[model samples]
Target: MELEQFEHTIRKLFNKELLEELDDDYGFTNKSRGSFKTVGYSTNLSLETIESAAENNVELMVTHHDAWDFIYGLKEECLKKLKEYNISHFWIHGPLDFVEFGTCTSLMNVIGIDRVTKYSIYDNGDVPGVGEFNEPIDFNVLVKRMRDELEEPVRMWKNNEKQVKKVGVLTGAGHSSNYIKMALEDGCDTYITGEATLYTIQYAQFAGINLLVGSHTFTEIYGVESLAKKIQELNTAIKIVKLKEDHFELNH
Candidate 1:
């Protein structure tokens, strides 16, 4: 399909108004191609991901995050490679986080969040953030479920022996103390996010909340994969490939 139509469909799928509220970098980073037969989806744009797209003959790449170094204006190499391969690069960041079946919601579904109680506020709107289980679960049991479902190492701060009932979720580097505080205020006994820092752990402990953290990539990958499926449902003619970052590993 034509890249323009594909992008239009994506915008509609993710809600155009929400996308407009995000930074300019949240959409098509580079449009080197006009059309594509195959599209690749991944959690982030990296040299390795670009190479994999090239190897898979993907004419377009839809990623959850732009290359981090692009903030420093140093993604020239990646840009050159995309140009060389004639691969278009598109990013869906905050919108994906806010959309239905998005990052946080997807993670929540995976871990059995029964009902949504609160949302994380973005610039113009809010997304699912805090939820509750049908019944309280043991903290260790919840951690094991997260580890098994995410298939990634889990780093946790077990603040108490309380059973996890009300829980908050924010995927992809969403482990800020501010979010933790919000969860606590929302009456969540547990909080889950992609990654956390020392301060995040301390704050969760002080706030008396259980914290469950997964690798940044693995936690957010589900949303991208879901997007790929959605795109394929829109246009079955356009092949969708889900790319993996084999190099990313969390060693504790």
Candidate 2:
């Protein structure tokens, strides 16, 4: 219940060495409460999410991604509310990305896989994560599988009719041609990620790789949810609320 207690538990489960490598922080650790009864979880430390936590009376706010060291635009606004409500904010970044039930693995699990092998690398060659699928599936069927697991529609750029045997998942903003190249080299017929650029579409067609691109926010929800579930299982008394923004779709 203490700040030290919460952080200690997190560090133990997520690995202290990884946390330091990511420079993960307790965003706002000061509070008068002896113990935290509720936890608010979000992907970013944005103004809207911070306000939602305060309104819900959440004692601690946990964000899976941390932007404080890079982005400063919304920090002041978010801090005002967090300070006012005496809510503590903490970030669990790279450590949560490749855990046993991490972002990439969770996606593969939802989409269904016979076995998994880690692929993507992060933090100086450490494989943060990627899943290797054994069964070859149709491109369209793979897209449907991704959408079914995401519970949201995905925008796809289909290239050759190659049945997808090896699929690589990177979760958010992982739609670059470079990643596609990696997939191709690794013999992946399809690359599944959150968002894509116009250039990548044509590239995929030429490279003969299929892609499933969905909303960034939508693709990134699983990691935090999985973490919360584990945390709650360990500490049955804390209330964990996942605050999410509704899907915003744009069409032209």
Per-model TM values vs. the true structure:
0.91, 0.86
* Root-mean-square deviation of candidate 2: 2.8
- List model 1 lDDT by residue over 163-239, tens digit each: 98998888878867877777787888988888788899999888889988898898888888888888889888999
TM-score, cand. 2 vs. native: 0.86
Model 1's number of clashes is 0
- Model 1: per-residue Cα lDDT at residue 105: 75
Taking the tens digit of each residue's C-alpha lDDT, what string does model 2 give over 100-210?
777777777778765677634464633424455576777778788778867777888777776777777777777677777777777777778888887778778888878
Query: TM-score: which candidate is best?
Result: 1
Worst ten-residue run, lDDT, model 2? Answer: 24-33
Evaluate all candidate structures by whole-model CA lDDT and list the values in order.
0.82, 0.72
Candidate 2: stretches off by over 4 Å: 24-34, 67-72, 123-128, 132-134, 249-252
lDDT for model 1: 0.82
